[model samples]
Target: MMTKFKRLALAAAFGTAVATSALAHSSKETTSPADGSTVAQPPEAIVMTFDAPMRITLIQVTGKDGTNYPVTRTDNMAPSKTFQAVPAALPDGSYTVNWRGLAEDGHAMDGSFTFSVGN
Candidate 1:
C-alpha cells in the first residue's frame, strides 16, 4: 500500500523524467549563411551548429529550380556539435540546404534552411 505522500512524490518524479527526455533531443542552433537571409556573394561553406552532438547522415544543397549541387563533407560522419561542408561555386539564385542527422539521444533529427545569393 502506498501513502498519499508517496504517490505524490512518484508523480513528480515521472513528470520530471518526461520533461528531461523531451529536452534531450538535439536541435539546430544556427547556420552559416543564416536562414532566410540573402547574401551578396555565394557562401563558401555550409555550416550547422547544434545544441548537442549529432551524427549527420545526409546534407544537400539544392537550387530553386530543383537542381542539386554537390557538397563535400569533411566531418567523416562523426558525431559533433558543429558540421560543415564546402559547396561548389554557386550562381545567383535561391537555395535550400536540407540535412538529416541522428542526435546523441538516439533520436532522428532533420531540418532545412534557405538562403539566396544576389545583389
Candidate 2:
C-alpha cells in the first residue's frame, strides 16, 4: 500500500526520531545556579554543571539594563563542567546568563536565561 518514496520518507522520519530520543538529557545533569535560583549573598563564583561533559568557550553575564557584569577575578569556566569568568560582586538586581559551549556530541550550543539577585 506504500510507494517507494513513501517508504523512504517513513524510514527517514523513524531514524530521526530515534536519534533525538537517544540524545535526550537525563536527570543526572545540571545547569549552573540552576536556572532561576536567587543568591542570598553573591557567592565567590558562578558555576554551571552539566549532565554531561562540555567544552565551553564563552560565558557572559549581563544585567537587564544592558550592563555587562564583571566576571569575578576567579576563572569560572572549566573544560568539562563549567565556564569560569571573573565577575565583580553582582549587585542586587536581575541578571541574564549568556553562554556558549560545545555539546558532548561536538556541536556548538548556546543559550540565555535570566536570574534575579535579591528580592
Best-fitting candidate, measured by lDDT? 1
> What CA root-mean-square deviation does each model show from the true structure?
1.2, 4.3
TM-score of 2: 0.68
Compared with the true structure, the alpha-carbon lDDT of candidate 2 equals: 0.69
lDDT of 2 by residue, 81-109 (tens): 54555567888888887877777766677
Over 4-118, each residue of candidate 1 has an lDDT whose tens digit, in order, gives 9999999999999999999999999999999999999999999999999999999999999999999999999999999999999999999999999999999999999999999
TM-score of 1: 0.92
How accurate locally, in lDDT, is each candidate? 0.96, 0.69
